[model samples]
Target: MKNYWTISRKFEQNMNRLQKPKKETFKKRLQNYLIKFKTKSPQITEKYKYFLAGFIEGEGSFYVGLKKNSTSKYGLKVDPAFSVTQNKTGVVHLIAFMVLFQTGRIDFKSGSENTYVFKIENRQSLVEKVIPFYKSYVLPLTCSTKKQIFNNWVNVINKLDQGVHKTSEGLAYEILPLVFASRTKGKREKSLQDYQKLVLLGVRQ
Candidate 1:
């Protein structure tokens, strides 16, 4: 025998050449990988993900504040915050949310008998982490009102990022009428006409 092993190797190569492996598309490859990995140890549990989304849909708020500030550049300050208010009995849930998200603070609602609010006021954290997470996971599951509010909030943030909030009076004028419009049970600012008057006074001063 010349070499049985060499002959067997050549035969296997010829067979593989006739029956080549199928090329998978990138989408399919990614799907397969996600399916394999999702079950192992997902970053967040399905229970927590949907629960948070639903809770926000029911009780959360996205607020973009544009108030007259004499000390700030352009005589205006932008305060963008996210909050979810719940009864005192649900403090544990709020705490759980804080632990899971690693952002926001739990506090008693002022002038409230049995209410607490979980609020996140850090601009950097909201833009970089919290907002992005909700946009991807929580937003889709929310109602149209919540979605619209979030979209407006994001618009304010984008304008702020471009320095439009500081320099462009037109931008602030355009956005102020939209902020806090959906707030139901909390401090609702005065009418847009009042705001316009205030802004005009600030510009004159």
Candidate 2:
């Protein structure tokens, strides 16, 4: 069955490869490529899949770290502080967002103050998302450093609900940001590499 939600799932699988391989003999970082790129789930992808190919080909604005993507288009930043969980690849240069897709929360108006903790309703980023390149490839990748950043994300989200104003830009009926995907540089260079490998695999399949 063709799942309506083709976006995030592709991301998860892609992110898996970017994760530190359990066995030291692991090679081919393709899977990790796709998953890491999953963070930037823009509305265009949600409404239309035209960008899917280019996205897989590493043609958009995603990087590693807290810096903003040169290709950062609006609308992705739907919520005041909500970030999509682009977990597998690790830190991009920018830090626009990094939250998992969290839907079905108790109703509340925007601009209110409260701490919200939305559980992983659909997808979420894991360890590989935060592993550094040197650590990922050279040394034994661990989650100790990643956990701190992960904790920061949790803290931000929790704090948002705890009194931070969830304000929007005027009366615009922006769809509430239920999903969080972080934007960053590509896996290989400034784009995700795992995407192409998966596409090839998909073709082979």
Best by lDDT: 1
lDDT of each: 0.69, 0.28
Our model 2 lands, by Cα RMSD against the true structure, at: 22.6
What does candidate 2's lDDT look like per residue over 1-205, in tens digits?
A: 4675686788888898788566521122322322544544233333233223222123221122222222323212222222222222322211221221112122122453332221112112322232221233312332454334334444333443453323322111211111112332234332222322322233222
TM accuracy, model 1: 0.67
Query: By summed lDDT, which 10 consecutive residues of candidate 1 come out lowest?
Result: 33-42
Best candidate, TM-score-wise? 1
Residue lDDT tens for model 1, 1-205? 5589889999999999989987765346434533533422234577877777777778877877666777865566668888889897666666556655666666689999789898888888788877877987787777787677788787777766777655445544765655545344465566666666666556624
**Number of backbone collisions per candidate:** 0, 49
User: Which sections of candidate 1 miss by over 4 Å?
Assistant: 1-44, 180-189, 203-205
